[model samples]
Target: MNPEKLAKLQSQVRTGGKGTPRRKVKKSVKPVVKEDPKIASTLKQLNVQPIPDVEAINMFKEDGKVIGFTAPRLSANIHANTFVVAGKAEEKSPEQALSDMLSRMGGGSLGPDSLSQLAKLTEGLQAGASGAGDVDDDIPDLVASEDVADSKTDLNAAD
Candidate 1:
């Protein structure tokens, strides 16, 4: 072998064919679900009955927010007063919610007294919204006014 050819061959490093062979891992097709037997057993033993014929359910939250559920599945355990409502929760404004509640109550018939009370309530709400004036405009000027306080006190007076 020629000296030049031998040096060239020695400088090159040997490697496995292509690269290291990778193992084909089998992935699970179904997800693994974990359940608690304690809660499940007691819930199954309860005599919870379904509340049928309910059109929808509305829940009122703070800040005049309303949560509504349409065509919900309502179940109640009358013995324990435990109720379960399952459905898709939605958002509705206070006006829409009030209208819906009225419509549900006896086909939306309002007497004279009910109309007057509603009108009064709406007027009260509107009066509070009477545009934004200057923040300190309504506050009276606070000055420490004590004109009649006795200023002369004897330091060495004996009782």
Candidate 2:
């Protein structure tokens, strides 16, 4: 290779200017603004705790639920009772959803035997779907069947 070409290549590699593309700078997320100080104080009085580490809370949330622990700030006149706000767990994967559902359904209380049943159900569903059968069967027929069934049951019971 020519000395000039080699030097240019070396410079390019060193400076990351030749083949490397420039990355777009990310816009910073702005903090949520509470318009009313009275509302903020009310919330503060309710003893809503600030999450010590938001990143840790995020990690805890990944396992299905987030548990926040915080002491009320001394300045605020908080109530004696502790208040908790629970939001739905956001599952990114089917496995996570299944795990979360099982946990919610008292899988821990049922012990290892419950896990076996869950595994069997998962396997059966997978096997059933692998065939020519409709995948929609996995989903509850909420639109028509449930309402029809409920109406019929209600009518029969009324009679």
Candidate 3:
């Protein structure tokens, strides 16, 4: 090879002129504020002591009972405000909004016991409306053995 060509090739390799671009150096960012001593002190005061691995704290419980401390604090004021706002937004009463929310939460319009009571009340209302001996003898027993067998057959066929 020519000495001049060899020298040119060596220079190119040494300088990385024909290779990948050099990465840019990043500027260091300074924090906006100094750490507050009061905040630091508060954090130190609130810091729970580390329990030994062998004697791990039961976060879900204390003593033999479920820990009440684990429950999130109920903010009645916030709840009331949210309820009011939601009611106004939907043109509904707060009570209506609360009922709707309960229903959406899989609680239905009434609680399980409340529903059972309501059902009994409705039955009593119907019986009272029809007077004494209002129980219709024509209504067939829904859970008879033949009905059960038919239902079982239907369910099995569906599967």
RMSD of each: 17.7, 16.1, 27.3
Give the per-residue lDDT of model 3 (tens digit) for 1-159: 899999776665553355544434434689786547885565455542322222111121111122221122222233234210111112333233333444555546577776575566556545555574645669676656888889999999999
For 27-121, candidate 2 gives per-residue lDDT tens digits of: 56899954478766786667676444322112233223334322322222235555433333343433444455566557446577877877886
Best by lDDT: 1
Candidate 1 lDDT over residue span 1-159, tens digit each: 899987655444322234533334434579776546874566667767879988989986644557998899887898888877777898986556666766677588877876676666546434444432324467687875454233323322432
Structural RMSD, model 2: 16.1
Which runs in model 1 stand beyond 4 Å of their true positions? 1-43, 106-159
lDDT of 2: 0.52
| Clashes in predicted model 3 | 0
The whole-model lDDT of each prediction reads 0.66, 0.52, 0.44
Pitting candidate 1 against candidate 2, the one with the higher TM-score is 1
Clash totals, every prediction: 0, 0, 0
Q: What TM-score does each of the candidates earn?
A: 0.42, 0.26, 0.16
